[model samples]
Target chain A: MTDRSDHSRATWRQSLQGWLWVAPALLFLVIFVYGPALTNIRFSLFSFSAMSLDWDFVGLNNYLRLWSDPKFTTALTNNAVYAVISVTCQVGIALVLAAVLEARIFPDFSANLFRTALFLPSILPVVVVGLVWQLLLTPTTGLIDQILWETGLASWSRAWLGEPDTAIFAVIFVSQWQWTGYIMALFMVAIRAVPRDLYEAMEIDGASGVQQFWHITVPGVRETILIVTIITILGSLKVFDIVWVMTAGGPNHSSEVLGTMMYRAAFRDDMIGYSSTIATVIFFIALTIGLVQIKLQKDR
Target chain B: MATARSFPALAVLNRVILWAVFLTLAVICVYPMIWLFLNAFKTTNDMFAATWGLPKIWHWENFSTAWNYGISRYLLNSLVVTTATVVVELSLATMAAYALVVLNFRAKAAIYTLILGGAILPPEVSLIPLFRVMAETGLYNTYFALILPNVAFGLPFTTFLIRAYMTGIPGELREAALMDGAGEARIFREVYLPLCRPILASAGLISAMRVWNEFIFALTFVESESVKTVTIGVMSFAVALRADWGVLMAGLALSILPILATFLVMQRQFVGGLTSGAVK
Candidate 1:
């Protein structure tokens, strides 16, 4: 490699030129991701709102005051529920679906069609997903309740997205429906990557199908599972669009996650300082969990 | 005795039940659009009477109203910002990915960790600071506010994807290219970049959708009516018509049309993009 490099002025030039090419993106991140993150920490220390230019230096008060706010407490609980429940249902369903699809029971073409069909919902715009679900779940005229009534199961019907008890769960269900297939596809690919020989050998040894899955498939995709776990944790924590659109964390903030709470505080309430504080807490939660996860994985 | 004979029959019944369950979900997933498409044509009266059943008359004009009223210049705003973002994001991501994979920087490991860390930093945290910067730089309420931030947020994902694909590339290619006196730029152009077209295609598709559909930042950062992107445009329409069912649905459909169309047509790219390095 060095010998080739010595004679090749072009290679050296390309190496230098490549940095120049990518410099803009790096600069963009420096200003946007890194720079803004620092600014967020700075904002947490200062009293600032979008409405006024005069911000006082109030060190740690914002973070300290968050502990006293009932709204933050409720929001923290809601975010916890949202993250845990959504990720479990979504990833668990994904694993089952991936297992089912990997069996290759259907004709190849039909199987691909089914896979594609299942994957379609994930790519649809979140606004559309929320609206479509809202309409479908509308209590009075909604097709879901209407269908339940028509089918003689009126007792089973309820205002799925409108009721306080059910709205968060409804949103979570919608998220699960959309995201499960996507993660399933990931599991499918990971499953497919495991050498067929391993599975065949397990079968040859008279291991049950379930046994093969436990012994061969799960181990093969442990890293991918961790990846999905982190993705789901981070994504679920930041999930605002669906919650914001569907219920606006409503039926009276019953579904209010941190994201919605932050949005309302900053934009709706004009309390930018409070919102940045919430944003700080959120950042710490995401960052700490992510670091802990990476540490665990590394230790493993 | 009867139960013992039923095992084979039950096995067949179980498979059938599984298939039935699968198709049931498929129906649930696809049924929303059937209702949406029909409702798009229905009067609000029809919508209230029943969520299902056919419209008395097709109201294709809702599309026009949404376009003319809700989208209009907002559509142009979306196109401009998304195009600029995808173009810039991909070009930069590709170059950076090449460096991360091919070059051995002194802090290469740390750089990689930084990139991964950047991926988890939610964009909302930056909203106020970004707004302040945009205001200070005098780019607030302009397309630049949305475009520049979108690109930055998009970079980590695209870079993650391109790097995944780059790992599969053989070191010998670089060596051979170097032996032939081709510079790294020439090799990236002649060898790596073209080989990465499929991955790039997916990255571009994902970035476009994200930029187009992004709402929170666009809502906050872009305030001018002329500069508003479609998501916030539709959102504002919904807010104004909070009690008006027909107009809200109309706005929703209108906002979704571009993304829906792009996703439907280039769905393969979306799927490819999701799997690229997203699930790792």
Candidate 2:
């Protein structure tokens, strides 16, 4: 009887071992991620301050205010411009470079070196990239302006970051510079993963480089392209550090994206309840775009 | 000229346009860093006077000065954070992945799908709430605050990736071990860990890069200089010394050097680690 009971004990432990396998990770996600998201939604509905545990429900007041907030409108428009311009350049250039790298069309070592150099900017901290660009594009004392003046184009010197007209574009360009490499690497990896036999079949059909790329390479990595697009769009929407670091949403709050605006509202304005509203807006916007991308990909 | 004759010229013009576009992009990509590189070697006056021109004298001393400027301490801090987090995360992820994949359990699909969907949520969405939570829990402004969240958020995704990769492994190895009367935990420790090394290495390195260069959390979570990562250190340097582009660029270069070194020395391993299970 004792031996049989020990055998049952062993079986129980084995069953637990199965549960234990995924227990820690799932627990962490559930507690930190899922729990926080639920709490976020809850807080978004209430009038809770950061220091207060109990608050009255504000209902849809936060959302209603967002409809009339000019700051929110500017942030949304700037985000749109940033997203459109950055995503277009980021994806388009990444594909071209990846194709060139895959074709081995450039001189030996040159292409790989360029690929590595391009990849370097992506890994650098956004804060540092922001600072570098801030200095490079500064108005009176900036290197770019100084260089233009020296090259006999003194009239071209402009305060790139200080002008409201050019400030958002500057931030977008900084973001674009940093991300293109990452997207390029993503494209390269996707290109690399395309099975060799598919390329061989295309070559047999007398397909040119451009034709084979359009038909075989693109089709093979359709999922990858979808994933990249979705991730890029989400990343652009939540862009905070580089803009905050470079421009501080400056030149009369011209460069403020949704993320930075939300941060300032919570931390600086000390409006916790209102910031929760902003945060919810950011979340919904990101989620909507993300879901739409996934659905679009599914339709394809 | 005949229209047909112009068609050949048009095709030639198109080829020239394509090459021009490609080369123009290459220049745009390389020239910023080239500008930074040249600017790093000039005096303060030279940088101001000849911002776009060659440095009168190579002030390589700026690199030395930047090196002396607590980039060392910040670099050390960044490495410590990354290494500790990677070790903790990989070990936890490995144990979790093994159990999730190989073991039989109830609620498996529901639990797994719930965790998988959490992967889609943007992390910053919960920042305000998390900050309040962290403060109430007495972990605010501490390394524990940063480390805990990093591990917590990173675990699900890493575990999911590892479990999927592990599923492609043959089941016979574990079965053979079981037949030999080896206990489950022992089989996991000795057999499973060794087999998971390649993917573990990859996952660990990727997490390390993320934590090492992570700015928003580091900025929000740790305010004091002592607890700050190299990322914050670089940001502070720029703020404190705005006009010193030479030192600032040198500092930026210094900050990224460790991560760059890790990539260069173990590039194959890093690449393998980066790309594994990611495409799927």
Per-prediction DockQ comes to 0.40, 0.40
Roughly what TM-score does model 2 have, to 2 decimal places? 0.89
Q: How accurate locally, in lDDT, is each candidate?
A: 0.77, 0.75
Q: Compared with the true structure, what per-residue lDDT tens digits does model 2 show for residues A23-130?
A: 777777767777876677777777766677678788988879877988888999998888788768777767777776776556657666666666667766788778
Q: Give candidate 2 misplaced runs (Cα > 4 Å).
A: A1-15, A48-56, A146-156, A289-300, B1-24, B58-69, B264-272
Best by lDDT: 1
Error of 2 at B218 (Å): 1.1
Write the residue-wise lDDT of candidate 1 on B1-280 in tens digits. 0111236777567568768877877777667766676677766787888667787777777667666675778788889999999998998889888877776434445556676577888888887788889888999999889989998998988888888888888889988898999987898899998899888887888788788778778877888889998777776776776565655676676666666677678666666666766344
For every candidate structure, what is the RMSD over all alpha carbons to the true structure, in angstroms? Answer: 3.9, 5.2
Lowest summed lDDT across 10 adjacent residues in model 2 chain B is found at: B1-10
Which lDDT value does model 1 have at A160? 81
